[model samples]
Target: MSEFLTWLFATLFVLVVIAWYLTYTAARLDRLHVRLSGTLAALDARLVRRAEAALELANSGLLDGATALILAGAASESLESPAEHGEARETAETELSEALELALTEPVVTHVRDSGPLGQEQLAKLASACTRVQLARRFHNDAVTDVRRVRRKWTIRVFRLAGHTPMPHTIEFDDQMPATLGV
Candidate 1:
């Protein structure tokens, strides 16, 4: 009887420990998800700001009509993209990045910088916006990577600690700064 009681108590103790570990894991995962959510929101805001800055530059008469039109169109498409339209949003952002790379040549950047104080300020704002977008995207992607690492754990999968939470995907878009505007 004494041995049986000892074995029962040990089993209950092990179960309690397992329950505690699972709870801790779930909480950690929940926090990571929340962090990922916040980072995504920040990334979205940075993207919108970047589009707005590009559009403003396009409309400021800094570039030739064709270049300006291309910039404006890409920026408009990015701005109009719905958040839930994941692939479409990514495509629009990629198009904007390509447009910026094509339009902001060294001479064009120099010309805009030398145009006047307002042009210089506008170009600076656009450059800053581009930098912010890059940083925000990196942060968001890092969060996704962290969450994915945790989600791949065997314990998480077997116990379904993540519940119905969808796996987070890293955002992949060309967010490189234009060569001439790397400032």
Candidate 2:
């Protein structure tokens, strides 16, 4: 009888340990999920702002073909019904393509008219901004991957048993940024 009791106690202790590990994992996963969501949201807002800036540059007669493409992509995604606006969107895309072709074939002027800094300095700042944005996006994706991996573990099936549903990939926007910032 003592032998049986000892074995039973050992088994119970092992089960408890497993349960604790799973709970810890779930908690960690939840934290990562929240962070990933927030980071993605911020990134999306920044992307929209950049796209708007590109559009503004184009409208200012800057002859920035890249900006035209950015504006077109932003417009395409922002539209609720692509089919309804297909013709107009297509025309815009064609124009943008021509602009890009022209820009690529011609020599690019490295001049910066924003008198605050030299053109090279301004270009460096833009490059740094682009790098930071890409890094943020990568970090967000990494967090998302970790969270999803934890949630998919067989030991974490208890979450499903408790009616916890898996989260879907979501892109959130910052409300503080202008609508142009979230295009």
Candidate 3:
């Protein structure tokens, strides 16, 4: 009888430990999902801010006609891209980055710097927004990677700890900023 009791107690302890582990993992996965959502939201905001800054710079009459047109078109495309069209949005953002790089050439930077306080301020704002976008993208991708790693664990799969949550995807785009901007 004592032997049976010992065996039963041991089984109960093992089950309790497994339950605790599963609960902890599920809670961690939930937190990671929350973090991923927040990071993605921040990334979206930064992208919008970048497009808005580019548009402002384009319309400020600070740049020449041709460059201004290119910048405006790219910025408008990026801003107008629908959330459902993920690939289109990525492509538009990449095009905008390229356009910004080409438009903010040496001569344009020199002119902006020489234009005094307001030009310098606008330039600074645009540069800051671009930098923020890059940082946010990196953070978002990192979070996606972390969540993917956790979700791929055998324990998570066996216990269905992640539930019905859709897998997270990394954001990929050419967010390279112009070196001339000093970002």
RMSD of each: 1.3, 8.6, 1.3
RMSD of 1: 1.3
User: Alpha carbon lDDT of residue 36, candidate 1?
Assistant: 97
Clashes in candidate 3: how many? Answer: 0
Which pairs of residues have clashing backbones in candidate 1? none
- Per residue, candidate 3 scores C-alpha lDDT tens digits across 39-155 of 999999999999999999899888889999999999999999986427888999999999999999988988987888878888998999999999999999999999999999999
Q: How far off is residue 60 in model 2, in Å? A: 4.5
Task: Select the stronger candidate by TM-score from 2 and 3.
Answer: 3
Stretches of model 1 off by over 4 angstroms after superposition: none
Off by over 4 Å in 3: none
In model 1, the Cα lDDT at residue 54 comes to 95
lDDT of 1 by residue, 1-183 (tens): 999999999999999999999999999999999999999999999999999999999999988898899999999999999886378899999999999999888888998999999889888899999999999999999999999999999989999999999998989889987988964
**What digit string (tens of lDDT, one per residue) describes model 2 on residues 108-173?**
323333423443343343334344445565676677677667667776675562236555442222
Mark the regions of model 2 whose C-alpha exceeds 4 Å error after superposition. 1-8, 59-61, 64-108, 111-129, 158-164, 167-183
